[model samples]
Target: MEKKQLFRNSVFILFFLCAAFTVSAQVRVSDFRYIDNIEGYWTMKTKLGLYAEKWKRVDDHTWKGRTMRLQNGDSSKVDDMRLFLEGDGIYFTIAAVRDSVGEPIRFKLRVLKAVGFVAENLQSPYPQKITYRWKDTKHMDAHFEGKDGRVSREIIIQYTRQ
Candidate 1:
């Protein structure tokens, strides 16, 4: 009976540890920032064109984001997004709908490339990967890549803390 009790206790502890690890792996949305800083409205300019967006933290590992073309200045309808922080790196996903009525219409936004030995490079990174990069406390660059591989652009956004 004692052996059985010990085995059951071990199983309970293992389960508890697994739960803790799972929770820790998830990044909260509220902590979303470019690089590791620069939060709030951002503007990005790329070879394609200019775009702007408002990034607001919704939770610890989640953020509410909206991107608009510079010409129209109208917000794109984004459904949801998830943020993850890896070792020395941050990643996020923006649920974008490419077409009005297409199946499997959602695409992911991820950090594909990191340029610069220092985070303060003035020239924007190439081949848009993540939507935002923290160049410094006051400067950031927002990047957007399309799902179809037909459209990809980068925007250099400078910001001030509100």
Candidate 2:
């Protein structure tokens, strides 16, 4: 009976330790450091063509990026983006080349963690929420969700580090 009790106690203690470790392993959003992980070239293939997105650090607190199509060894710019830390939070903006007015749609970073981040723009007509999740160092997923009129839609893109 003593040996049986000892075995039970050991199993219970091991389970408790595992639960504690799992709870502590979750990441908390403290700052924008995780955003730097995306500084490089990323690519995704679509039915239209192969598209690429490249990111460059403008300063310690800002990054500039552009999405383009790779065709016949030439690239056409689709959208320009800027991500920066401002006033204790981070913001993301994107401007399409056709928008000559130079106003970019803006999103505020609402959720940030070691795994990824979520940004939302309630005023945007299309995508009100944008989420980026890292599968690993070489792969990431981008999700855009919003409502167009009363219809809801979502787009998910998987990007490979290039």
Q: Best candidate per TM-score, number? A: 2
Q: Which number leads on lDDT?
A: 2
**Candidate 2 TM-score over all chains jointly:** 0.75
Pairs that collide, model 2:
none
Per-residue lDDT of candidate 2, residues 5-119 (tens digit): 9999999999999987864444233467888777899999877788888989998889898889987677789888888887766888877511245577778887777778888
The stretch of ten residues in a row with the least summed lDDT in candidate 2 is 22-31
Off by over 4 Å in 1: 1-38, 45-50, 70-91, 97-131, 144-162
Candidate 1 C-alpha lDDT tens digits along 29-138:
33334323433666656565555566666655454566555544544543444444445444444455323444322223222223211111112223324445555655
List TM-score per model, in order: 0.39, 0.75
